[model samples]
Target: MGASGYILRRLGYGVILLLGVVVLNFLLIHAAPGDPAEVIAGEMGGATQEMMDKIRADYGLDKPLIVQLGLYLGGVVTGDLGESYFFNQPVIELIGARIVPTILLVVAAQMIAITLGVGMGVLAARRPQGAWSAFVSVFSTIGYAAPVFWTGLMLIILFASMLPLFPVEGMESARFSGGPILYALDVLHHLFLPALTLGIIFLAQYARLSRASMIDVLGADYVRTARAKGLSERKVTFKHALRNAVLPIMTVAGIQFGNLISGALLVETVFNWPGMGRLAFDSVLRRDYPTLLGVLFFAALMVVVANLLTDLGYRLADPRIRTGGSRK
Candidate 1:
């Protein structure tokens, strides 16, 4: 199929997947023990029947499950995510406000992970049995196995407490007022530690994937032919081998982006970063159904979109797959 047709198909599939996600999230949230109305009533003082009933009626919780689901699905179609019971704001607006920080954190972390991972993988692949290779392997394994929150704490202690370099928590320094460039720098300053914590957690997978892919690509006949033809080592390795090997790394990176968002929840909680992950965390704590559902819907949508982009990227990176060829 043509590129447009391919994209259209993917978009349609994405819509269906998002709808499924909404239904499943709705069901799951409702299935969980505890009534949102009761929780709200208790917070207001006591869960008397009158208070509970009024709360339920206010939020449509009194409606039948199927009817509530239908209403929610209808609102989703109309771009209305309902209101946040705890925050007393529109769910979409609350999510929209926090999404920026989450995106920044995720993008920064991915860039760090990919750059370090791919570079180390290439270096290790070049000298598979060397000391550097062994070190990379060991470090990557440790990075992969470490818990994200633990990593964040260690970073905070070492960087924020001991050395006193980056801020221990938050998206920016409260004391600073500056222009766009300065503001960007300030945000990056606070962002570095959490981003690094998240990046380190994901880096190992990419490093391992890249190393394996590079080793396999290097063994291919074309690479040997390129070397035999007196091509420079750099050209043979990068132009011939790395180019072909990057496809798998790209795929892993795309999938990991979704995982990283989930991981960011813990990282954000640890660092007290104001992001959607933290928002989701708060929503869950308060049993705020609308806000939690909104976050889940957006998170699932992002993953679906990332997967679609990854497929398109595959076609662009390797022309063999552009004409509806098998990815394999």
Candidate 2:
């Protein structure tokens, strides 16, 4: 299909996928071994049957499962995600307050991972047997294997505790009042560790993938022809090979966006960043179903949008994709 048609088709698919996600998340959250009414009642004090029953009735938890699901679906269709049983706020408002931090964290992490990973990968590809290549290999292995929370902790210890380069567990300096520029800088300082923690594994992944793709692309006939024409090694590698190598990287990056968000949950928890991840963590403890559902729904929406953007990027990067052809 043409670009417009392609986008329209993908959007249709996204809507359907989101619907399925809503239903599935609702069912799975309910099926988990806990009652929101009881949890809320316990928070109020000891949970008597009368109090729990009243709580359920108040939140519509007293309804049949299918009926509740239908009501939720109906609310979702009308942009209502129900009320937060714990926070006593609208679900949308809670998510709206926290989504910015999560977006900033996710986007910052993505940029860091892609830039460093591709750069290292390209460097490693240029000299497969060199020390740099070995370093990249080792770093990738360790990064890929390490848990995100552990990475965050180690960073906090090294940077926050020992060296004291960055703050350990917040988004900004609470006492500092400054202009927009200084405030932005302050936030970036806090963002570094959490972003790095979330990005490391993906960075490792991209590095390995890019290195292999670049190596393969370097051996292609087009690359050989470019080099044979006396193009500089730099031109042959960067201009000819790297362009093709990055296609696979883009694909993987898009597919892994969801995982990146999931990893952020751990990273945010470790760093105590005031993002949707932290909010989701709190919601789980409070059995705040509406808030939790809203987070999941938004997260899924983001993933779908990311994938669509990735497809458009593919069309931009590869003429064959634009023309819907394998043969150039």
Candidate 1 TM-score, C-alpha based: 0.97
Query: For every candidate structure, what is the RMSD over all alpha carbons to the true structure, in angstroms?
Result: 1.4, 1.5
Give the alpha carbon lDDT tens digit for every residue of 1-328 in model 2.
7778989999999999999999999999999998888788878878778877888898998999999999999999999999998889899999888888998999899999999999999999999999999999999999999988888889989997689988888899989999999999999999988898899999999999999999889989999999999999999988999999999999999999999998888888898888899888889888899999999999999899989999899889999888878864
Clashing pairs in 2: none
Worst 10 residues of 2 by lDDT: 319-328
Q: Any idea how many clashes model 1 has?
A: 0
Evaluated at residue 214, the lDDT of candidate 1 is 93
Q: Whole-model lDDT, candidate 2?
A: 0.92
Runs in model 1 deviating more than 4 A are: 326-328
Candidates in order, TM-scores: namely 0.97, 0.96
Summarize candidate 1's per-residue lDDT along 1-328 as a digit string, tens digits: 7899889998999999899999999999999998888778867878778878888999999999999999999999999999999988999999999888988888899999999999999989998999988988999999999999889989988997699988978998889988999999999999999999999978888888898899899999999999999999999998999999898899888878789889988988998899999889888989999999999998897788778988888889998889756755
Best by lDDT: 2
